[model samples]
Target: MSQTLKQPRNSTERAGFRVDLQGLRALAVLLVMCYHIWFSKVSGGVDIFLMLSAFFLTSSTARRIARGQRPPLVDGWLHRFSRLIPQAAVVIIGVVIAAWIILPSTRWLELIDQSSASLFYWQNWYLSDHQVDYYAFNTASASPLQHFWSLSVQGQIFILWPLVLAGSALIWKKFFSRHNFAWVAGSAFGAIFIGSLAFSIYITATNQQVAYFHTGARLWEFALGSLLALALPWLSSLPEKIRRFGGWAGLLTVIGSGAVLDVQGQFPGFMALVPTVAAALVIAAPAPRSWTNPSGLLSLSPLVKLGDLSYGMYLWHWPLLVFYLEVSGKQKASFLAGTVLILVSIAASWCATKFIEKPAIAWQASASFSRLIPQSGFKLIAQFAAVAVGLGVASLPVMAWENNVEHRRAMAAAQTATDNPGANATEGWDPSPTSLVLPLATELDSEWQTPGEVCEGAAAPDDERIRFCEQGGTFDGGAPDLVLLGDSHMQHWSAAASAMIEEAGGSWILVYEPGCRYGSDADRVKETCSDFQDAAQDYVADLAPEMVLTTASKTVARPDAMLRSPGEQEILVDNYEAMIQPLLDAGSRVIAMRDTPRYSYSIPECVDSNKDNFANCDGSVGYALNSVNPVEKFLDSRDYGDQVVSLDMTGLLCPEGVCKAVIGNVLTYLDDSHLSKTFVLSAKNQFASSFKEATNWE
Candidate 1:
């Protein structure tokens, strides 16, 4: 992409003609395109591309300095970003509008956040912070901006690289060889390569997900390219056959990387060296001899043209793939369908490059604008202002519309509350299935403020401590507690429990671990969750809490076992028994509420598409009711002491032979299994009465 850079005339003449590199760009982008569209694989193409970008940037900057043309740092920054932002902003804006129109409103806030993060090139961090399961294409909708992670990494390097180059130049001129600028730069890059490589290896091994998007872990690839650029003069001096051999070998490596390696899971570590070094060999190889130089294929006119459009292709392909998936509702596409999407992506890329990218670059390059403006950064200011305005325009209205829908739904739910033939909710929870109060499309972000506001992982001295919460918004540390234990199923029921505990009069402690089923003494694998359960056992034993409320369940479908075994059921009961054994011995009764229904798809998405008939999204009563179908049977087989009382919510949730997505205007489940805090709150009256009857709570 030297063509993208504006080099000094002398430097352009001397460092001119690496059409091979342009061809490499085309190859890289195409690999990413095909893999994303059809194969659902990572190609290592982005890694190679990152290295090539750094190589060219470093080489161009060094050449400018050698020619005594002062490195126009601010101007370079502006030029690169301006060249980038127009195309990127266009894609982001297009995606924003597309998401609003095509996707259910449940997806709006995330898309908005992604768009804003992409605009500032902090997408990688944003996604990581949100703990998005980047690998889970089957379970979750892939964000269109997910591919921006690489762009964001490159953007960070683009800003920081020039400063490092300038500093290295100063040290070389003042102390090191003045004429041997390449040696100084290469040595600097060599050191960076070593340090960054070590860090990359460590981070990738321990935390591959975070390492995958981390700019720090990726710095080695860029440094490897810079090292190659500075060593090109020596490599070019090699025997013609050797250099030609290197080129062919490198080309094969670049093309075959995806086939040979698991690039997605083990990237930017030592594994990344395969493609980066191959790209280096290609860049360093001298002008190819007629003896079958792969450069000839790479430098083909059409390939080079595609290379020019590579950036746009990279930007456009992902959103198109995501849009297609959203429409198709399939995890992977068929070859024919994927091909059409790819072809359209290519066409879109070409138009964007020709009409938007090329014109924008030309204008920015030809402008009379001062590079000094970037010192004060009007560009950043303008970009943030644009994002703020865009988000306000995009999100505020959606919020209002969702709010209005929720308000009307709430009114309907109120009527349902009055009209329903309430059952013996305590003996067996059966509010008799009223209408859903909240819209199926409602995100219930406000309602998600449970299991309570301050809930999180254990927080002190690298030691996990039990979590305590009080009814009526107070947490007294030394109170005889009403403990809620187990996973998110147990966590979600806190709304009802807290209200009942407050009415019954005592402080309540919520000992919740999201994924763990309250297994004890190493039965749980996650250290924090395991520790939370152990700590809960210890606390309940000593405190002798009046009641320990928990659910015996798992949210993910155990299809193999749901009908046959509940293979997880034995594990669930064992963990629960162990957890409450100590509490039972200490005279504390265990209140085992059964888990709710689990669905395969997003309930909100289903509801949005089928609003007037939400039962369309409902699952069969036999398949859906965990508490009644499997949990009750399992509980009957166990003798967890007489004080241990089992509560089934299935009667309330599955009143008409189907477990519906919405009940009493309360969206029953937040995702697919766990009840929404609002739904729990709505059913609290019945829950309290049940508690008073079952345990004789005062």
Candidate 2:
């Protein structure tokens, strides 16, 4: 048996040459497991696994159909469910129970919600929309079931792949033979592979976050593998030397891919081709001599045994890693510790596979013996119903938590009193904005909105020079002489700035974008924020006001770096030097305002969710503490910082290092980070003196 498993010498010389493709299966699964565990750079394992899945599932289904047998869709689905669900269920239940014990109350609820979503297929979309950082940042929480994203993608394929094969087989029987069907199927899949690859590459370049989650972009890799399987009979006819060469080359390609790739490498795009193609090549080749087979690499008693438990291992590993991280609060495990962890995980996976999975599958298979037996058509329908109920139940808390109107009303009243102190401190702050406030309420509304707009400020000007200097259509003649140039951060300070400028007899002009930062590069952006930075720059340089002011969120830097990278830092410095040099040379001052500290809690939801407990609402403080400060590092550069005046707001928001989101029913922030309009309006008076000193407003 061992000798029979060895690589074939020649095609004609060897009859029924066996390649141990399951050995390749062992290879594919292990590669993925290792990549997830440590390497972080290579997605070669995932690409290879995708190809293997296409090869096995598509080829097996097509063969069954071509042999004039109708596949039992329900039974086949049951088999797949039996194979996958047992392990998945064990992981989900274990993770959920563990999370309930270990996580904070708020986070525990989020885990329950997310885990339930994972049981259904929508977890991919859920994580994608949330922009869940899979690399697991130090401050952020990890999703134990995140690895299920790939499994969900595969299950999606399983759902539809057989139907395509069955449909193609029907057409072939009506018009031609089984051989013709393979060719037709191969051609169709080839087209899908090509189109999907192009789309994947395009989306990765355009919207990588979206591309990462998109199944459409990933589907082609699998199709490519399936196409190879359809052509296997023709490939098997090749000379033994060619077949043997292909098999060896395939293994080399896959292993080499794993060794070379890493986290920083681009993925699921054109880069994935190396391992995917190699997997196809390996699948096409016949088995080596059974006993002396190079297939022994996968067939090793230990490896094969691990391979049997691999499905469960994959399900359990991530959650375990997450639980460890949560409990220990450290990402890097010592080498020995990591090794021990892996061994423990492997043992647990075996138990899960042997006990939970094997028994559950066996019971499920025996129609009458299944636990949680559907008692209805196909377990999927029952699963779907259960999943729907779970999700609906999960959503209720979030909705109820967010919809607290009484909290908002009370918050509004307190803010009104703070803003209009001189207008008779009557009956605890009038609820209406129309009462007892002049420029305080209306002017504040225009600048610091209740729920900020998507994009804001002046029309694009024709001359780049005149535009970049000016803020919001050539000096609106409002209050402040100093112009605020940039995005929403500048907008947040607009009301306070206006009050200060008015008191100091100066005018304020703002050139800004709603969801943008100051000085963002145009080429870097794909959506609405693309042209925003350049447009604002033109306004600042053109207006040439006495001083330019702006602020930004620190976390915005990461996504910005990704969008327009390479020489970005240098380019930004140059642009600032060039744009502001002309202003400074022309006698205009440049002032870089320190961005306000983001609230630890989402203020709007806080009043409702935690009902006044600021400490409880705030999440892990470590990440929030590390968030960016525009003023902190603005002076690092030689060119622009020389002319920049720094204004620190840390004292205002976080006095004594503790920031409160709600101060006596006055919510400080409308959302997670940005300051609320009502809060900003009330606080403008406090900032007036500082504004006068910074801008030299006379």
Best by TM-score: 1
Residue-wise C-alpha lDDT for candidate 1, range 159-182, written one tens digit per residue? 898988888888887898546888
Local distance difference test, candidate 1:
0.69
**Could you tell me which residue pairs clash in candidate 1?**
426-690, 435-664, 436-665, 437-664, 437-665, 437-666, 438-665
Alpha-carbon RMSD, each predicted model? 5.8, 9.9
Identify the leading candidate in terms of lDDT: 1
Worst 10 residues of 1 by lDDT: 1-10
Q: Which runs of model 2 end up more than 4 angstroms from their true locations?
A: 1-22, 72-75, 97-117, 127-142, 178-180, 205-209, 262-264, 288-292, 369-483, 487-510, 513-534, 540-548, 551-650, 654-685, 688-698
Question: How well is each residue in 1-698 modelled by candidate 2, as lDDT tens digits?
Answer: 00101111232244442335545655665666566556533446656666667776676677777677875476566556445655566667777667656654334434555675677656767666666332111125567777777777777777777777766776777776735678877877888889999999998788776777678888898898788878888887887667666767877888778777542246778877878777666666555544333454544655555555556666676777777766785764556656666777778877866776555544443444255556444445543433344445444543443343234445545554545443123355443443322222112223344121222344335543322222322235422257766655666676667566555655556565565565544423645455656555655566566776765323322214355421122122214444455556755667766555454333444444454254664433222344444344546645553456666565556545656554433555555556656567667766765655665546
TM-score per prediction, in order, is: 0.84, 0.67
